[model samples]
Target: MIRKLEGRTWKFGDNINTDLMIPSFALAEPEEKQPKYCFSANRPGWVDLVKPGDILVAGNNFGTGSSRPGAKVLKSLGIICLLAESINGLFLRNCVNYGLPALPCPGVFSSFNEGDIASVQLEEGKVVNLNSGRVLATTALPNMLLEILAAGGIVPLLEGKGLLDKAR
Candidate 1:
C-alpha cells in the first residue's frame, strides 16, 4: 500500500456529495475523458488546478451521494488519498475499490487548510501537518483493505491471487 503520503492539502467541508465531485453529466464519457469534469460543478477549474498526489482533507460525511463515477474521476485526476472526519460507506468502498486510500481523521479538516503541506502514514494512522508541524491521529486502515490498495485495486488484487479466473 501507499504507506506514506505527502502532498499539499485541498480542504473541503462536510457532506460533499458525489454530484460535486463528478456531476452526472460527465458520467456518459469515457474514463480517460472524465477527469476533466471532476469537481467542475462545485469547485470550478479544479481539474486544471489540482496536482497529482495532492491530498484532499474534508469534514464529516464526505462523498454522501449515490454516484460511483466520482471516485473513478477523482482517481483519474491523481488524488493520492482522502482524509475526512467521516466518509459515506458506499463512497469509501468505491474509493478503496479504485485504489484510493480514504482515512477517517477526526480533526483533519480544522487542523489544516487549503495549500497546507500534509503527510499521512497509513499503517500508523498518523496525519501530520507539514506546514505547521501539527499531528493528528486517524483510524488505522484494515489489513485487507491495505492489501487491496497494495495490489492497486480489487480487480488486480483478485487477479494476483488467481481468484478471478477461478470465479470465472
Candidate 2:
C-alpha cells in the first residue's frame, strides 16, 4: 500500500516553474545538498518547514517551466505529491521517472487557500479536500511507481527488494 501522507498544509500559486521547484544553480552542489534547496522561490522557508507527511496544495500550472531535473529533487524534504490544476508535460514526465508524485487537481486550490490540513491517499489516488468535504482529484501513479512512492522514493524501494545488485 502507498503510504498515505496527511498533516498541516502549505500552498503555492500558479505557474510555479521548475526553477523555483529546484533551482538550476543548486545542481552544482553535492547530491546531499540538492534536495534541501527545492522551492526556493514561491516559498523560501518551505524546504525546511514542511514536515514529513504534510499535504501540499497548489494552484493551476503548478509546474510550468523549463525541463530540468531540479524539479524532481525533493523526495528528501518530504513533499509527498503535487496537487494542482495542471502540470507541464516535461515536468510531469520528469517527476514520474524520478519517483515523485504529481497529480492533476483543479478544484484543490478553491477548497483550501493554504495552511489547512488535508489527507492524501496515494493508492486510492485521491486527495481529500478536507475543508470542503470533497475529493478533489485522482493521482496518476502507475503500479510500479506506486510501490516506489509507498516505500518512500526509489532508492528505498530498490533496496527493499534487493534488485539493485543484479547489475553487480
Q: Evaluated with TM-score, which candidate comes out highest?
A: 1
Runs of candidate 2 exceeding 4 Å displacement: 137-168
**Candidate lDDT values, in order:** 0.85, 0.70
Pairs with backbone N, CA or C atoms under 3 Å apart (clashes), candidate 2: none
What TM-score does prediction 2 earn? 0.76
Q: Model 2 — which ten-residue stretch has the worst lDDT?
A: 70-79
The regions of model 1 sitting more than 4 angstroms off are 165-168
Candidate 2's displacement at residue 55, Å, is 2.2
Q: Each prediction's TM-score against the native?
A: 0.92, 0.76
**Could you give candidate 2's per-residue lDDT for residues 87-150 as a string of tens digits?**
7777766666667776776677777757777777766667886666677666556787666655
* Residue-wise C-alpha lDDT for candidate 1, range 7-80, written one tens digit per residue: 88898888999988767777787767767877776788878888898989999999999856567777778899
Candidate 1 residue pairs that clash: none
